[model samples]
Target chain A: MSALVTGATGFLGRRLVRLLREDGLQVTCLVRPSSDIEPLRQAVGDALWSGVDVRTVELMDENGCREALLGCSVVYHLAAGLSGSTSTLFLNSVIPTRRLMAASVSAGVQRFVLVSSLGVYGTQTLPPGTVLDERSPVDPHPHLRDPYTFSKVVQERVAWDAYKASGLPLVVVRPGVIIGPGRGVLSSRVGLRLGPLMVRMGGGQQLPYTYVDNCAAAVRQAGLAERAEGQVFNVVDDDLPTAKELLRLCRKAGAGVKSAWVPRPLVQPLAGAYEWYHHWSRGQLPGVITRYRTAAMWKPLQYVNDKAKAGLPWRPEVPFDEAFRRSLTIAPAIG
Target chain B: MTTSPSDMIRVALVGCGQIADAHLQEIRKIPSAETVAVCDVHQDFADQAAARFEVPRAFDDMQRMLSEASPDVVHLTTPAHTHCRLATELLQAGVHVYVEKPFTVDVREAEAVLEAAHAEDRSVCLGHDQLFDPSWVQCRAMVQAGAVGDVTHVESVLGYPFSGQFGRQVATDRNHWVRKLPGGLFQNTISHPLYRITEFLTDDRPALHANWFAGSADVSIPTELVAHFRGEQVTGNLLFSTRIEPQRITRVYGTHGALEVDLDAQLVRRSRQNRLPGAFEKLEMPLRHCREATGNLCRNVWRFLKSDIHYFAGMRCLFEEFYASVRSGSPPPIPYEGMLRVTRLMEAMFEQCREREEAGDTAPRHSQERIKVESDHTIKSDQRSNQRPVTTNRDESRELQEAWS
Candidate 1:
């Protein structure tokens, strides 16, 4: 079987490409013109690579997207803009996904897999006695006004809407903050900076997390399994601990950092003051306090991934603590 | 019977250990107070202290001492495990109570004392004296003023071998307070410096996540203790031990620079370029208000008596606040809410320790039964054969790193 994958150079996308290739499928990776191919090469070792922009490629007019989709029986769309201006989310995620779905339909691709985010469930401070599952309502807080989450939500909605209207086989995978060996934002920025001194946000009880390899495995399972069609899975592992426990894991993994909880009330004013200063100074303000306070990364958001497990036959390969430790050694290829 | 200002604060010394001497000396220095009575679990010890300090009253029973002396404040210098029970009973009897560190072995008991204090409308204070240290207070003020731009991290270590003088009672008891405390050194000793350090850095209280291993529990000493504490904008590690030989250090890393304190030497080091001329020199000088007096007591005593004074002052402050609240309808400074938060943290540490032990990763090293030899000839042969030569320094260092890695 032939498969076409977008974002094949990305952390998750690269992993997916390898898994599909290992499964004996002819994988064609759609890469950006500018993405460094070294890591992807390291990951997939000379898989058939295609360089093209999905939106600009006159896929329908010149049949470029359709051509890529032609021989491929399955289409895996994983690429999405993580951050930019608010409007960029709509343009980058929603539009491109719609275009890809349309192109897949025209090319008669048998199955479609779309990678979404647990962020689409939005910023959840899961109440005591309740755990979030796929059926839980998405938070309406406008995705933290973050382009990454906004784009993800739009992307999922587009895939869902298109699948409903066109009766196409679609599987949407929403993975909690993806963490793995040298992948994901937390591993890249947060893990590297962790050490003996780390200020834990608010008693570090709130849960905000993901593991990369586990999420990738879930995505791969969804792509291959017929049971995953028409399903949306929240991919997370068990033994999810409070933020404080996560920090302890980081410390054990040699991050050796301290975690302190800052009271919200004290930091809230500092955030407001930072925003005001930024506005008054025309964005000259450093916004350190404001950035720390506004970023609700420490808040609890528990997700249940039983649906993914039950349907996709997926299980997390690495435990959370082991994955966290491995994340420290994952050096990103800096361009 | 209204008393003059000179006799207003009558004090009783409870648990006459090494710390009680410091408290008695401080009381001698305070003009309005006198140590009317001394109590110890051992009658001889109480008699010795009463005679040495020229006190009129001494008792083995705490209740007898409290009733006869009618002390306005009771200085609790007992082991941490007993602080809650004694403090609760004393507070309920309308005596302002001061308890030593660890405040209580458990939070629930600490809460019970606070509840009792509330019911009786009396004052209670924990002996966390590092909070009042001038250097710490100064450091706190600077961080609050943005001296080290947005204090992000703090590291504290209060590590040392078990004191040479910890005594036979502690040595013999397997489940003694020192050996069995939730976090061992992290609680019994490091908590003093940790609480003080956090109090200085942020107004926000921290949630603690600790991973501890039994470093030398086999040697009948507590192991290397490490804890990570997180606040909203700050994170810190508290590393402590009763095995590592005499080391006291604390470092606070901020965005711009770092501030470190060496408690043993009483030195404060700042990483920033321009510093005050006498800042380091001033730290070398002994602490001045040792016994609540206005003048320099550091020179007279060569040691600060207020270490105990500071310890007892917490109780005094707790009592003064409680008395004011009862008389004028106000709240105490060391409020129950604050104590509750501290208790929760204490409970978490205990839970983490129990969890680690249950996982079998932190089993006591000394729990293994020693093999008995049939005779001296057999014992000598076994000792000689079993003695593996110690690795040279270079190989030892490499092996240590590899083990940790």
Candidate 2:
């Protein structure tokens, strides 16, 4: 099989590209013109570089993307704008993805796997302790969330819209925070780093973490699996640690952290108060904490990857402790 | 001097860019303003915009649009470099002009445009719509009402995202129009923070010192600016940063209190002196914050229900005021003096930046110096030859379990 991967230079993208190559597939890496591919070359090493084809094409350039996708049967699109203003995020991420979807349909690709984020779920509105699975609805009002999450929600919407309209083979893999070497272990899921102080929202909430290699494998499986078409999979590793346990592990690993814990019950009210203050003060302090965002981040919920495990027939190869150890061996932060 | 309510103001738009859509959308909301024509150098864009907005006419040539459409008012949403000539031509053709921000390339061009408007007896408005945001309007009203006492200082900080479409275009494309401007990337946006400062500073020529440098390694053109202006009694600072979290806020400090306006969020907040004594003040502050926040939440909910909340609410308000001015033959929404002052300030800052660029002194110095200082300090402080290595790499999972035990 020949596969094309966008964002093949990113942390997770590099891993996915390598894994796809290892599975005896001819891999074509679609990178932006300005993207630095040296890191990708280093990650793939000198030996495996023979089978990998690198194509410099902007996703917004429909003709270029169509040309790049000419021989590729499967496409793994992982490129997205992580942060920006709403319009910026929409233009950079959503609009390009829409164009790519159009180009993919035109190219007659077999399968198009979209790597989305678990943050797209409308979990805050759900009752606490609800099992957040593939069936969970995405954010209804994405504009109320941060620009990054808002863009992702819209990107998924457009992907589904394409799927419904053109019968494009689509599979969405919503991965949790991917942690590995070079990338830090900390994420907003654990706590927000507000300057020197970390505001750890709640302790009992499970940190839905998928090690980068494990996430890449699941994404590969999603593209290859026949059952994954027209399905959404939540890619999360088993034996996840709670936010407190993760913080404790970090502290034990000689990473000094100063944290203030907010109890689970008080999290929502505190966020409301914080949102109120942030808005009332005309953003005197950064509007990092808002009621909607806090609810989305800290709400106590259970994550299930049963659909992914069953449909993709995949299991996380790396144990949580082993993954944590490998992550800490190179970097202190894991996210 | 005024048109009847039944009479509509025929409006044409030039440069069918991203902002042209905003102008057209807001114009459509007002029954008094009729979008008669849309024009762009790119004829396809003009046609697309006209079709999308249901405008009657689309033309690639400005002269043809003006002559054929006969629009009473023309919105100049073209590039800043083209703004001066376009505004001048539009005014000479007996039409009022509304130019987008960074009104012109420099004060000279701004003067020429204003001169043309004066000669034609037509009103001209710059797109300084942030000042017209409901939050900012309320903040200004509070300041005028002495709620914030006498203004002493103003700090305007704008956080731009280099990953944004405009930023990417400017950074990647060397020949992009924004790169050709006097201030390069900063010229396109520095006007926002500058005008916010001038609203309170009210000084045409303030003692100014500006530092411009690229905070990120992506582009060479300056993306970060820290400008200080001392306006006789009040001191103002403008921070335009592309590397930070995106925000648009202006803070005004006064004798008794301070007020901040978050134009993006459309919220206004103030800080007053705490009268409580001792550690109780610390507890009092959060409670007060909650109270103020709750109040804003209630008000915002009301506004949202009333459909008064939107990304382009400020632009809509500005359009209404500008259109009203045009109909009544009154002065434009923004005073000519204020526009001139903002343009002059921008010219001064850009001049300093250009000088620094020519001197080859625009690169950020602190990071390089800090790296050197840290390396030297590390070399000087290494005196642990006899010390044993710290055993900090124990199995954290086991340690975490034991801590619970």
Best by lDDT: 2
Whole-model lDDT, model 1: 0.63
Docking class of 2: incorrect
- After aligning candidate 2 to the native by TM-score, how far in Å is the CA of A237 from where it should be? 0.4
How good is the docking of model 1, by CAPRI class?
incorrect
Q: Report, for every candidate in turn, its global Cα lDDT versus the true structure.
A: 0.63, 0.84
The model with the greatest TM-score is 2
The fnat score for candidate 2 comes to: 0.03
Candidate 2 residue runs with Cα over 4 Å from true position = A278-288, A332-335, B1-100, B105-122, B127-177, B180-183, B189-329, B333-405
lDDT of each residue in A245-319, candidate 2, tens digit only: 988998998877888988877887887887886555433444567788888988878988898899997899998
Model 2, span B246-348: residue lDDT tens: 8999999999999988887777888988889999899888888899889999998898656577677678889888988998988999998888888888888
DockQ of each: 0.00, 0.04
Q: Tell how far residue A23 is off in model 1, in angstroms.
A: 89
